[model samples]
Target: MRFSVNKSEKYTVLVPEEEKLDSLKAPQLKAEIVTMFQSGTENLIIDLSSVKYVDSSGLSSILVANRLSTEVNGKLVLAGLNEHVMKLIKISKLESVLELHPTVQEAIEAIFLHEIEKDIEGEED
Candidate 1:
């Protein structure tokens, strides 16, 4: 539940400070993501560099964020995942479903690129 949030015009970066993202913290994380979406945050970047462990509930929270982002035609990005967490996501077969980046900066760039793509598609329409 302990985290830092950096808000920008286009996206928000949420960095959970916990080492373990398990059932105990997953609910809070889900609630936070929902609240951000309700508050009109279309794009989100979750920086998981500090987290070394995660459970199914933790992955569920991330999935919730992705669903919300899709609902708003936005982007959900994960960054700085450690090896263990990455393996867990891959094992869950979520690597193909989610956007993963090596750093927050790269994630931000991806979001911007996604926005540009959307804009181009809109213009084409």
Candidate 2:
């Protein structure tokens, strides 16, 4: 799946226009997410609204992005998951580890809010 990037609130959004996200495209997606992570961004968001299908490998790609974000004290978020895909995440129990927003705008807002909350906590110390 090919994607475009839009940086917002120190976050990079991977907007993929692919119809499916499966094993075949998982590696490429993983690499793209890693590239964003390595670009010194504070957060990342994979906008999956246009993605209609996801297999285990696709899920693995998301995990890879999550791990990369964590390693850098950044965030990896998801947005606009269809019900079918949402069910998959629920079944996999990945929802707890990953934050999901109803829309890309919300995802950006969430990342910004998360950063603010972190700053507030640090200041309170």
Candidate 3:
């Protein structure tokens, strides 16, 4: 539940200060994501560099974030995933479904690029 939320015009970055993202912290994470999305904050970057373990509940929370982003025409990016957490995501078959980045900077840049592409597409329309 302990996390930091950094919001800007482009995106919001959530850095959870927990080593294990399990059932105990999943609900809080989901709630925050939903709240942000409902408040019209779309693009999100979840930096999980500090998390060494994750469970099904954690994965469910992530899925919620992704779904909310999709519904809001936004993007939910996961960054700084360690080896074990990455394996968990892959095993859950979310490796292809979710946006994954090696670093927070890359994730932010990716979101920016996507927004640019969307803006271009909008202009064409």
The TM-scores, one per candidate, come to 0.99, 0.93, 0.97
Each candidate's lDDT (Cα)? Answer: 0.98, 0.87, 0.93
RMSD of each: 0.5, 1.3, 0.8
How does model 1 score by TM-score? 0.99
Find the candidate with the highest TM-score and give its number: 1
1 versus 3: better lDDT goes to? 1
RMSD (CA, Å), candidate 2 to true, equals 1.3
User: What TM-score does prediction 2 earn?
Assistant: 0.93
Model 2 stretches with alpha carbons more than 4 Å out: none
Cα lDDT for residue 39, candidate 2: 75
Residue 28 in candidate 3 has what lDDT?
A: 91
Superposed by TM-score, candidate 3 places the C-alpha of residue 51 at a distance from the truth, in angstroms, of: 0.5
Residue 10 CA displacement from its true place in model 2, Å: 1.5
Residues 48-95, candidate 2: write the lDDT tens digits: 999988999999999998899888878888999998889999999988
- What 10-residue stretch in candidate 2 is worst by lDDT? 33-42
Flag clash pairs in model 2. Answer: none
